[model samples]
Target: MFDQSRGFRDDAVETCPVEYVVRKDGKPFAFLNATPALATRTVTGFALATPEADWTFERI
Candidate 1:
């Protein structure tokens, strides 16, 4: 009898860049840093809802 066999295949991929946050109202928004550009800035606070605090979170 004759032997008939198929060849094996290896498939793999690495991403050059990845997208994380989606845009909101044509503007980009993210709760956490994802991409290199997003991870560049230094963030240390969140939006607070208080009468005393001058700065608060608002949708642009």
Candidate 2:
């Protein structure tokens, strides 16, 4: 059960190393926040968004 509302932009592109970057929902941080360390301001990690897509930890 995958929720499509989780910012999975452009679901048509079936390829990866696709970055899963999520910035603060509002204006506070000047950068696009990513994941894994959500406790801090910026979260950074990897996401194999679909069977075809994945964001490697290196690019982040």
Candidate that scores best on TM-score = 1
The regions of model 2 sitting more than 4 angstroms off are: 1-31, 34-36, 39-48, 57-60
What would the per-residue lDDT of candidate 1 be over residues 1-60, giving only the tens digit for each residue?
222443332221121234444333434545443434433331213222233333312222
Give one clash count per candidate, in the order shown: 0, 4
Report the number of backbone clashes for model 1: 0
Tens digit per residue, CA lDDT, model 2, 1-60: 334787555633443233443333322333333333342222323122223333222224
RMSD of each: 13.0, 14.5
Evaluate residue 19 in candidate 1 and report its C-alpha lDDT on the 0 to 100 scale.
Answer: 40
Q: Give the TM-score of candidate 1.
A: 0.20
* Model 2 TM-score relative to the real fold: 0.18
Q: Score candidate 2 by lDDT.
A: 0.34
